[model samples]
Target: MSLAFSERARAEIDRLLARYPTRGAATLPVLRVAEREFGGIDDDVMVLVADTLDLSPAQVRGVFSFYTHLRRPGWGKYVLQVCATLSCALRGCEGLADHLEARLGIRAGQTTPDRRFTLLKVECLARCGESPVLQVNDDMYVNVTPAKADAILESLP
Candidate 1:
């Protein structure tokens, strides 16, 4: 019944647990470890994480499903989350999104056939002043235009 979490992940969980007073307080970090180890918090990972934290799988699932940073199955290597919040929307985020769809040949919430990218239309990325922002993996690009977005995509290795 082991989730086969790697030793590194176990060590990270232990470190994370030490910083929190209760296992429940460490839930997010634990799930993050699981996500890194398993590539996504699928059903099995949820059960195993619950077992490790002495919580129910349903509880783990609730938390896991709530966060967008957590990867789900089929998420591409590069996850491009375009901000669709009010600030970005007012600054032509919709048009940028449309441009992305046309350029990538895939709509939002879908991955390219090559599995290189997944375009997601997400809410605010907390960069309101820098409207029309999108995050590719850990990097955020602000004030992006269609041409700039295309150049960004082309620059990804």
Candidate 2:
């Protein structure tokens, strides 16, 4: 069976399609809707998105893979994406990634077994000055040391 969007997502897709001249132009927005509605963009959602946009699965997959914000399975309740770029790396973000992996008991790019956290080492987070930055889902935590990271993780419910 083909995957389907929820009513809310359908409405949003309709609005997006109206804004763009072609259905393909709405692919990214539609993908975001699917991600929000389904929690992540898995294989099934990729097919659905391709069908919705009148594009091939390869096309949708290409776009999906290009953006780090769009996630796949193994996503946890909180996704911690740390900057691995030069600025953050020079500021000791690698140690931060290691610290989180040890503390969460999952290596980078893996989700905790309990489904509570996922640690990912990403390229830039756009706050080079705030090196050692990581984004927990949409909210960014800048200047994160190991202690501060632990405290932040502990504070999450």
Candidate 3:
């Protein structure tokens, strides 16, 4: 199997490559495009990127493995990343996480049966001030209580 980049994605990669001195430096940016475009980076996608950039598969794989943002498999539309670091934990992240899991009927690292949501436990979202925070997709919700989280999840389509 091979991965193909859309014209728009290729253009974006070209624009990013121009800012970097070396093609290897463009790896992360290219991976970002691939992630947004294809949803995630599987082995085939990595190989395709290698072919597109004239880099070795190892090089492409290296970048993919190094980045936590890039998933090896596809993910649901909604990614609920709960902060599980010291600060968030102290603020009751564990209870928040449990509430989400029970309400969503899905455990951490698992997607809902309907494939509408994926619950994940992340180290930190850099919102220490917010303490108990959870990132839904690209948006961060700070100091989320169980009730607020339920309301937020219910609001999703």
Per-residue C-alpha lDDT of model 1 across residues 104-156, encoded as one tens digit per residue: 89999999998999999987799999889989988999999999999999999
Winner of 1 and 3 under TM-score: 1
- Pick by lDDT: 2 or 3, better one: 2
lDDT at position 157, candidate 1: 90
Model 1 segments beyond 4 Å from truth?
A: none
Q: Which regions of candidate 3 are displaced past 4 Å?
A: 50-68, 71-73
Model 2 alpha-carbon drift over 4 Å, by segment: none
Residue-level lDDT for 5 in candidate 3: 90
> What is candidate 3's lDDT per residue for 1-157, written digit by digit as tens?
6457988998899999899998887888888888888878888888888887789999999877754456545577788989999999999999999998999898999998777888999876788998799889878899899999988888978
Per-residue lDDT of candidate 2, residues 1-157 (tens digit)? 5579888788889999999998998888899899888878898999998988899999999999877888786688899999999999999999999899888888899988888888899988899998899899888999999999999988998
TM-score per candidate: 0.90, 0.92, 0.84
lDDT scores for all predictions?
Answer: 0.90, 0.89, 0.85
* lDDT value, candidate 2, whole model: 0.89
lDDT for predicted candidate 1 compared with the true structure: 0.90
